[model samples]
Structure formats: C-alpha cells, structure tokens
Target: MIRFERVSVRYEGTERPTLSGVDLTVPEGELVLLVGPSGVGKSTLLGTVSGLVPHFTGGLLSGRVTVGGRDTRTHKPRELADLVGTVGQDPLAHFVTDTVEDELAYGMESLGLAPDVMRRRVEETLDLLGLAELRDRPIATLSGGQRQRVAIGSVLTPHPKVLVLDEPTSALDPAAAEEVLAVLQRLVHDLGTTVLMAEHRLERVVQYADQVVLLPAPGAPPVMGPPAEVMRVSPVRPPVAELGLLAGWDPLPLSVRDARRGAGGLRERLADASPPEAASVPEPAAPPEASAMPGAPAPVVAARPRTGRFARLLGRGAVARAAPVADPVTRVDGLGVRRGRVEALRRVTLTVAPGETVALMGRNGAGKSTLLGALVGMIEPTAGSVRVGGLAPARTDPRAMVRRVGLVPQEPRDLLYADTVAAECAAADRDAGAAEGTCRALVSELLPGVGDDTHPRDLSEGQRLALALALVLTGRPPLLLLDEPTRGLDYAAKARLVGVLRGLAAEGHAIVLATHDVELAAELAHRVVILADGEVVADGPTGRVVVSSPAFAPQTAKILAPQEWLTVSQVRGALEAGA
Candidate 1:
C-alpha cells in the first residue's frame, strides 16, 4: 500500500539527510511498526507516506514515494487525504474543532464527503474508539490521553486506506493503549486497512506488529523483517525481549504469554530460592546549612533505618523504613476541581513524604492530570485544599512556588520559550539563582550530545522532555510533579532519568509523577496510587498495587508473578546471587 524507492530527505539547513537510501514497502492490510532510538528519522519516514516530509515540512526529497500507486511528489497532503490519514505526536496540533463530534467530522468535511456519509462515519468512528460517551465534550477539556484517542478517531473517521500514526499510544494508559491497538488490529484484519505507526514504548505495541522496520541510525540503510528478527539487534527492546536475551532463549518472546510458556525451567530453578530483597530507601541528603541559602526552608529529613550501599544508590530507602506517618511534603484533602460542568477531580486526597517517589496512575481522563495541575497552581481546587511545603499551591506566588514545587507538564513546549537550548538553560539557571552552568550541566546529564545551538522546537520529543525536566530540576524544588514524564524517551534515556530521580528522592525531594508507563512506575516509584473517576481507588506500595491489577502490571511482573517480581533487573540480581 505504501512504497519508498531509495528515498532520502534533507531539511534546508543541515548537510546530512535525516533518512538516506531507505527503500521499503508495506503491503496492503499489514501493520508495520517503525522502531529506532531518538532522532533516527522514524517520524521522517512516516511523513514520506503522508506527503508531509517534502510538502508541508519543506525538505528535499531525493527519490520517489507513493501511496496506493500515486506518487507523493505529484500529490499534496490535502489532495491525498482520501488515500492517507496521518496523526502526529501532538494531538492538540491536529484538532480543527472545539468538540469531539465536530473534530471527528472535520476531516471528512474537508474531503467534501456528503453530509450523510460524514455523519455515519463520525458515529462509527466514535463507537470504534469507544468515544461515544464523550462525543459532545469540548476538545480543550479532554485529558492528554483522551485527546490522543480523539486525534486517532478523527483520522479513522475518514476511512483512509493507509493510516500513519506517530506515537499513537504515548499518552494513553495501559488499558486505553490496548484498546487503541486492538482497534488498529481490527482495521488491519477485518477491514484491510494498512497501518504504519512509530512509538517509543515498544513493550506496548511490539507484539502486535506484523512487520518491524528498524531505523538503526541516520544515513544507515533501514532493517526490515519480522518483529523478533529486528528486535534481536535493535538498541531499544521491550522487557520481554530483554529477558529472553538474558535467558539465552533461542527465539525471543515478544509477549508475556510467550515468555511465561518458555520460562518453566527458569521458574523451577527459582522456586527453591527466596525472592531478591527489595532495595532499601537511601538516607535523605543532608539539608543545606541555614546560612548557605538564606530564607530557604530546611529539608524534611526521614528517620530511615540503615541500609546497604546498593540500596542507597538505587534510592530504595522506602523499603527499609517503617510506614511514614508525618512530615508530608505535599498534602491534599477533599480536593475537588471543576471545569465548567465537568467535575475533573473529586474529593481526591493523597500525600507524598520526603525521599519518596509516588506514581499516580489511571486510565485517560481519570483525573491524574487534573491533580497535577492543582498541585502546581495551574488548576485551582473548587471544593478542597492543597498544600505543598505548608503553602497553598493555588495561592502561592510564582517566585516562591518555584522553590517549593515545579511541574513539568505533558507538553514540554509549554515550559520552553527561548529560541535556543543554550538560552533556555541559561534562563533557567538565572531564574533559579543557581550556578551559571547548572541548568546546562543537568541537560547534558539528562540528554547528552544535544547541541547547545539547537532550537528547543527542533529537538525530538524525548530530547525536548529532557530539556524541560532539566529546567525544572535546576531549582531543586523540594517537591516535584511531572505529568506523563516518559512520553518519548527511549530505554537508555529512561534509565538515566530513573537514576536522576533516584538521586533527587534520596536527597529528600518528594517526586510525584502521573504516568501510563507501568515499567517506569515499577522501577522508580515507592508507592502507586490508582485514580478512577476522579478519585483514588487504590493506594499502596508499588509491588502490591501493580501486581494485583492486571491492567497496571508490567511485563516482567506478569511473567514472574505469583512471585512478586516486577522487573528483569530484579530477576537478574537474584540469579547472579544464586550463581
């Protein structure tokens, strides 16, 4: 359905082509997954099919690209709208209407479809994506994940033969992500629609791919084959694949079921051994001397028990301490936030203590983002109270709030305004009153090799996120809140972020992040709080909450449980000790 013939794309400013000599083809009715590290042209490759690369993006296209036998060079995006439907990473950027129903019909209306046809297709799409209940809701009021589903539904309503999705499930919770993927599966299997998608969260979608396309590096020829074949050498891999590699399995398993089926011997070997000890929380970093930073509040110290160096290094100190009963860095009581007629958050209450990391999780529109907004003063509570470091967030001055708390929203662009990365970092350093190069140093640590002169808008989603996170951390806020923090980060970047957050938590900084990435929660969170219908439904230690709920469990937990294991690293640690 889609074909590329030695296609190469080079933007106006740079010398090296983003994609070089990429000759590939996607047969009709097939679901092809584009996999690669950040900045490796996955987005560039997807754009070629929809004619956004050389057309809207103003790039040089060296070879022919066609969809359904019509060369993209001869057809612009609008002219080929009937043949291809594209959804970019940012859903808000794709909307042209205020409400869900209108957004779904906008594409069809642009194509000049008859009103009857457009109406029928709009309803069908809403039902297919499970958005029928939200049909009349305003687009601006939807959560990040809801906006994602709406964006996809808008494209699917057009019934284009070929669907191009960039990070389709990046913003969705696990269950919602499964729903979207299942819908795509039906389109490919039952309706014979061709799908080409690129996503950073491989564990969520890798198993569903009919074929895998790996863009290993810029200017390198692309690798195409079955999912397992590409994953064997791909730098980024799902946890199941990583486990398979570690266990020396002949054929790597892409899904949890397959991994479990092949793990009989390993499980038997582990049956006699006790599960590896959970890491102990590290000692909270000593507070800065009162004279060092005048007027700064003293850090809240946790009375943690002694732990080993490894536990301290991993920031697992929470495991060694008794239940925390006091000194909450953030407290919410009967918090309720309303937007117009919708009750976004209702009587939601939670607490985060110093040196602890809490992951707030729920389905899309489950009030996770709303709670984060309330914590950072972006959304005011209408019927309850919110406190960060003893000050009401909604009423705190912006300058003082920066020291007490910092929030990195789902869209990193909202925090960035400077033209260049260097300038942004400089501004952050100056505003935070930190050392001149502190922000840049944090950026280099979070995202190495990003050029100082690069524009903030030009960085990939993951890189941009890293920059935003660095900007927030420069202040060393006592309490940190991040919404969908791992949207575009690859595994290596995620690991680095985990380490950074671990260090911060060890230093008595409370970290609260809203995320759909269960793997991240399993790795970094001391506690898991599940929100549903704008209220906390489950709250407990990470292992307890995630393992009991199938929808929230990570791949490793699903495979290794009934055993309480949550990560491959934990399994590896146990095996190493036994060996």
Candidate 2:
C-alpha cells in the first residue's frame, strides 16, 4: 500500500538528515512496525504515508513516496484523509471535538460523506473500538488509552485503507494498550487494513507485528524482515529476544509464553544429550551446617520464589520495622482543586505514612494528577489543606518543601538541561546543598551501561526514566513522587525501575505516584489508592486494593502469585519454587 524510493528527508537543522536514502515498501494488508531508539525519524517515516511529511512538517524531501499507487507529494493530509488515517503520540493534541461521538464523526463530516453513510460508519467504529459504552462521554473524561482509541476511531470512520499510528500506546497501561492492539489486529484480519505503527516498547507489540522495519541511527540505513529474524539481530531488543540469542535458538521468541516454551525445550534437550560423569575416588566435601535452615531442606534452591528486586529493595528494611511517627508524612483533609473553570479534585482525603509506597491509579482526568499536584503544592487546594512532613505543603518554603519531598514529572525531559548525565546529577546535588555523588551510585545501579559522557537526550526512553529517577533521588528527600514513570519502558527497564523504587522505600523514603498501570502497582507499591471523579474510592495494601477493586483489578496470575512479581525474573523465581 505504501512505497518509499530513495526517500531522504532532512529538516532545516544544523547538519544531518533525519532519514537518509530510505528505500522501502509496505505491502497491502500488512502490519509493519517501525522501531528504533527515540528521535531516530520513525515518526517522520509514518508522516510520509499520511502526507504530513512534506505538507504539515516543512522539510527537504529528496525522494518519492507513493501510497495506493498515488504519489503522496500530490496529496496533502486533508486530501489523503480518505486513503490514510494518522494518529499521533498525544491523542489530546490532535482532538478536534469535545465529545466522543462528535470526534468520531468529525473526520467523516470533513470528507463530506452523506449523513446515512456517516451514521453507519460512526456506529461501526464505536462498536469496533469498544467505545459504545462511552459513546456520549466527553473526550476530556476518557482515559489515556480510551482517548487514543477514540482518536483512531475518528480517523478510521473515513474508511481509510492505510492506518498510521505514531506511539499510540506510549502513555497507556498494559491492559489498555492490549485492548488497542487487539482492535488493530481485528482491523487487519476483518477489514484488510494496512497498519504502520512506530513505538519504543517493542516487547508489547512485537508479537503482533506481521513484518518489522528497523531504522538505525541517523546517517545509517534501514533494515526490514520478519519479526523474529529482525529482532534476533536488532541492536535494541527485549530481554526475551536477547536471552533466546544467548541460548543459540533459531527464530527468537517475542513474548514470555514463547520464551518459556523455548526455554523448556532447551532444558529438555540438555538433559537428554548430557551423560552423567563417573564417580571419583576422592574425599567428600564437608556439608556446612551454617548453610542449612533448621527443620528445612537447605532453603530448596528450586523453591526460591521469584521476587522483584525493586519490591525487595523497597520492602526489605521496613518489613520488620514498626511505625515510629505519629502523624503521616502527607495528609489531605477535604482537598479540592480546580483547573480553569472545572473542579479536578473534590473533597478528597488521604494520608500516607513515613515509610509507605502509595500508587494512585485512575483514568485520565479522573483527578489523580490533580490530587498529587495539591499534595505537592503545585496546585493550591480550593477548600482543604495538604500537609507534608508535619508542615502544610502550600505554606512551606520552596527549599524546605523540596528537602522533604521530591517529584518526578511525567515528562522528565521538561526538567533536564545539562549536557551530560553526570553534570545533570551534579547540578541537582549542588542545588540541594547535599553531599557530592550522593545519587551517583544509585544512578549507576539503575542504568548500568550509561556513562558520564553520555548525553541524556541520546539515551533511550528507559534510560531517560532512570536518569530522572536518579535526579529525584539526589535530594534524598523524606518523600518521593513519580507520575507514570514506566510509560514507555519495556519489561526489563520496568523491572529495574521497580527495584529502584523499592530500594527508596526501604530507605524510609515515602513515595506516592499517580499512574494507570495496575500490574506495576501490584508489584512495586505497598499500597494502592484508586481515584474516581477526584475522590479516593479505594485505598489499602497494594495486592488487596488492586486485586479486589472493581476499577483497578489486575490479571489472575499476578493476583494469585502475589510476591508482587513485576518482571520475568520475579515470575521465573516464583515458578521454580512452586510458590
């Protein structure tokens, strides 16, 4: 459906082309994944198909692009609306209407489709995207995942043959992301729609891709092939694929189930092929009584339950300790916050202890972010007060407040400025007036491969998240706050992050984050707080809160095997132990 010939594109920048001599073709009814490290022109290539490259984003185009046998150069975005549908990373940014139904019909109206045709298409889209229940809801009231799905439904209403999405699931929770992917899969299976998507978290979508298109760094050529073959040799890949590579397996697996099967086969083969060694006439090594547990079978190595390093790091010190402080670190009494003319938070009250890790979860605009803002004094409460570390967060001095609490925003790049990672760490330390290299070790632990000379922007999204966490840890505040820190990270990175957070909690640093990832909450958080319409609906221990709640319950395995296993390593440990 789409073809690019010597398509070299460069913006009016200092030096290099974003995409150089990219020669490729995407056949009809194919689901192609455009993947690479951040800022590598994946989005730029998606734009070419939807006619947004040379039209909306002004750039030098040295080659040709054809879609459905029609030259993309001759058709603008509006003109190509019937042939191609484009959804961006931020669904809210591209919204043209206020309500879900209106948004879905907006594109069809623009295309001048008849009323009967528009009505039929809108209904079909609403059902296909699973938005029928929320048909009349306001676009502002939808969750991040819901909003993205609605954005896609809006474009697909025009019956575009090709669908192009740029990081559509970047901001969604795992369950919601899965819903979107399932819908796209159906579109390909039922309607024969051609899909081209760009995303950083390949682990989530790699299993669904029919073909994979990998774009190397700038000035480098692109690579294309089957999903398994391409990911087997790709520079950046998920841990499962890397493990398969190390195991010398043919056609690496994309998901955990496949990996498990492959691993089982390898183990069986090893067991069958190896012969037992002959007994040697040598003195036996003495068994150490110190290594054995009283009345137990030496701790049963195979029975050692898988535990998330982050969860252990956070809960390690606090598991046996009792609470010492009388008042909680943060206390919200009848809190309410307003944004413009709307009330975001309403009569919300909650308290977090000194050594607690609370995960606040709710749909987008459900008031989770608003409540966090009020707690941190970013937004003033309209009718109530918020106390952090015994003092009102609103009345506390800026420096004093910062010393007691640290916040890591959703977009960490908004706060990052230094040229190097080490320099950024140093600058944060200097501002806090703390000891030198206070957070250096922590940063190195989270990002093992990162160096002092590495530029923050050059790193992957997962690396940026680690750097942000490190920057926040530099202050060594009593409380740490994070906003959807694992949005774009893969399974391995998420495991590392959970470990870091767990460690912080173990060190007696209270943390409260607003997020939509229920599994992440189940694994890392000691407590879970559910918000709806800006009020605290559910709050308690993480497993109980998420496993029982109507709005926040996670998967069956996660609930059943509750050591808070957030990564594959944790799951494997639990499985081997029969826990």
Candidate 3:
C-alpha cells in the first residue's frame, strides 16, 4: 500500500542525491525488505513513506510518495499517524513516556481511541512481544534490547495498517529476535498488515521477506525481485548465502535448514579434514603519527599471543607461558548486582589474561552488560569484588581507570560529544594522554573513507560505531569491554574491526565483548561465555560451546553439522589444504 513514483532526495549541503530515481510499489499485506551497505539511502527511503522525508527532515523531494491513497507531501507525519507506525534506529529518541505500559498506551490515546479498546490492544501487544513481565519497568532502566521491544510495542498498540521498522532486531539476542520476527510474520499473514523494514543483519530476516529491494550503491536505483534473485547480484551477503556460493550450490540458501539439506556432499568431502586452528588476535597496529611524534612515549610491542584453537587451550592452562605479566588483567569474583528489584548479576566469576579475547553471550537482559559495567567502574556490585590490574575498579580514580580499562557501551553516542570527527579524535587523544594524532590514525585504519569534517551525528549507525571504537582504543588500555559491538556494522566493516581487534590482542590487551552475532563470536572470539538469568551457563572453547547449542551456532557450524566447523574461513582453509 506504499508507492514511490520516480522519487529522488537530496539534502541541502551535498551535491549527490541520497536516493536517485527510485520507483516501486509495495503490495498490500506483504513484507518488503530493504537491503544495502551503510549510508546507501535505505533509511532515507523508508522515511519517504512515513512522511518524514521532506516534512520532518527538511530535504528536497522531487517525486511523489503516497501511502494508502494519502499523499505524503501534503500530509505531515502527525497527520498521517493514523495510517502509519514507524520505529527508527534509536529507540530512546522515539520514547515519550517513562514506563513500558504507559508508552504502549500513549499512541492509542493520541488517536482518540476509547479506553476499553486501548486496554485490550495494550494487553495483546504485551503478550505478543513478551513484554508482560516488564510492563511496569521504567524505559530508562531497561537494557538496549528491552528498549527496542518497548519502542516496537508502542507502535504496534495503535494497530496501524502499515509498519516501518529500521534494524528491528539489531540489538536483540537470537531468541528475542526470533520472537519479534515471528510476531511480524503473524501480522503479515494472519492480519494482512503491510510491513517495510530495513536491516543490516540479513541472516536474521532475509528468509522471511516476501520481496527484497536492494540499493546496490550510492546514487544507484534499487533492484527489486525475489530474495534469492536479488541476493545473487548484491555485494553484501549473509553467512548462509556465502557458504552456498563457496560450495558451488546451484541456488543459494537463505536459511540454515536450506543449507543443511544440500550439505551432504560437502560434509563428506570435509569428514577427513579438521577445521583450522583459531589464530590469536593479530598484533595491534600503531598509528604512524604517534610513532613519529617527538617526546611521545614509545608504544609497547608485546610478544605475539599463543597459537591455535584458542589464545591457549580451553582446559587446564589458558594463560600463555610467555605472557608478560603474571597477574590477570581483570578479575571478577562472586559478583552480584541489583537494579531496583531485579538481580542483574549474581555470583559471576571470570578472569581475562593479557592478550586474550572473550565473548559474553546470552538472551536479552542476561547480565552481560552488567558485567561489562562492573569492569569499567560504571556500576557497583552489591556483593563480590571486581579488580582491574590489581586495583578495584569501583574504588580507582577516574584518570587511573582510563589506562587500565576502556568500555564502549551499547549506545555509542554516550561516548561522543564533539561536533566533527576531527574534534572527537583530538579530544580522545587528549583524554588518553597520548600523541595528538593517535585517535585519528586509528580511525583512518578502522574506517578508511570517512572524512574529517563529517559530523558524528551525520554518519550512519555503523560509521558512528567505528569512530567510537577508535576513540576507545586510543588509550591503549590493558583491558577493553564492548557491548553489542557489531550492532550496526555490516560484514565488511565487521571484518575490518575483527582485524584491528586481533592486532590489539597480539599486542597484549585483554578483550571482553558482549554480543549476539553468532558469526562474529565464531570468527573472532577465542573463548565463548554464555550467560542466562544473571548466571554463567556455559563457558569453553568456541567450537565446543557453539557446536553444542542450536541457537548459538553460526550458519557454517549448523550446515557442517557433527563435523565441528565453526566458520566459512575454517572450511575454506581445509579445502585449500587439500582436504
């Protein structure tokens, strides 16, 4: 029920248009997916249907966009609220009420719905989205994934005919993502609701799409067709599609079930072979400017980390014999954290050695973020102790803690304040007490094409994440913590980040990141630690941990089955080695 007629959008400052000559008609009661790399106008196009393009964002729109026979150009976002419901990238900005129950009811109140009708719809949405337990919780106190559900539930309560979602599952854990996607499926199938969604994580949503619209590049018109047809020509792809292409399958698979059904011959070919040893994090790359600066302290070049499978083997001795320091970089002992009436973490104990990479994984609100906060001195544990480099994180001075540990939270914007990228880098350098150009050089390495003049807010979510990571790494902290680190990054950007993080581990920095991307955990993490309900459920080598669990396994691991292959890289390595 959405139509775009020769639409093109251009902002005031730049010469190139964000979207060029895009013409498409979204059929009623179908789910349409918008796929592309970052900054390719996917978000801008979604804005057009909700009357946010020219009406709210102040951009020039050359063509017409209509939703359900109503012209978006003439009807502003407020006027069209009855027909459309939109949930943007950041859920915090979309919130107007304090509590979950209040937020869900506010939309219907504004539409002048009767009290009884609003109450019924609110209860249905709460049960459908699994937010009944959190109906009374404050929006500010919920985790990132929880906030995302509340935002979606708020829009859903109004019962609008058309729904527009941007990265709906990016912040959610695997099971939680599945629940939200299943709800969307019901709306599309049973209720005949129309949905248009833009997301970077194709692995989670591609198989559910009725039609796929691809924006191949900047200033390029979109290609529309079935999911498989468009994915063959698209530059970016999910792990299942990547594996299908690698195995020379006639038709690429979009889901694990499809890939497994055709993986018999490929698994036989690999039965005699073994997956490649997981390499240690690559040596950290030093900024050229920092090395050349006069009077700057020389960067420490630590020994390369232990070889294979993990930083060290999963059992017995995990710390390398050649490690520079005898003490662990960070330690948590019987940790317990309480937020209001909920126990966020309890009796959680873990340790990270020099040059080790660990991934914390679990469902939404599983205490992963709470553990990171304890390490970074942001939260005080109600019970137990937290130590970073022999100093208590909660008791240490702010300046001293910066050198010991650095954390990049789920909201990357919290760490950003400067107007321009250059200014942000300069401030990071100063805060880290490092060379003037240190942060910028790291930014250049992580995000190659980003300009210095670009505002942090102007950049897409992925670009903003890259810059925030660079800023945090500038300090050269002994321990680093990242929460949902790959929230907005595409595959290419994620590869670059993996390379950079590997190098840091090689330079003897301890890495602890909380994430939901199974592929990332398989590719980069030396060890996987699973948490559930504020307790560690499973912790071991990457292969053993992921291969045993269906929800936690990557596409490659799922397809290659009882053979224990975790990623496509390992499979390719076996093939190249004559297996």
When superposed on Cα atoms, how far off is each prediction in RMSD? 7.9, 11.2, 8.3
Residue runs of model 3 more than 4 Å from their true location after superposition: 280-326
* Residue-level lDDT tens digits of model 2 in 1-579: 899999988877426788898999999998899877645678778888888888988888778999998888888888888899999766777898999999999998998999999999999888877789889888886656678789988888998899999877776665567778998898898889999998776766888999999886754679999999888667667556655665666667777677665565444433323221111112223235312312112211111112477645444212111112234677676677876667787666565666678888876657776776677778778887788887888777777898988888766786789998889989888987878887677777777756687778655555677788888888878878888877656455677788877777777778898887665776677666766667655555565556455456543223223222233344344444443
Tell me the lDDT of candidate 1.
0.86
Backbone clash count, each prediction separately: 6, 8, 5
* Backbone clashes in model 2, listed as residue pairs: 303-577, 306-573, 306-574, 310-498, 310-499, 313-502, 314-502, 314-503
Per-residue lDDT, model 1, residue 66, is 89
lDDT of 3: 0.86
Error of 3 at 492 (Å): 0.9
Error of 1 at 426 (Å): 0.7
Give lDDT: candidate 2, residue 469.
82
Please, what are the lDDT tens digits per residue for candidate 3 over residues 354-415? 88888999999999999999999989999989989888888889888999899988889999
Clashing pairs in 3: 281-502, 282-502, 282-503, 283-503, 284-503
lDDT of each: 0.86, 0.72, 0.86
Lowest lDDT 10-residue stretch of candidate 3: 316-325
lDDT at position 406, candidate 1: 94
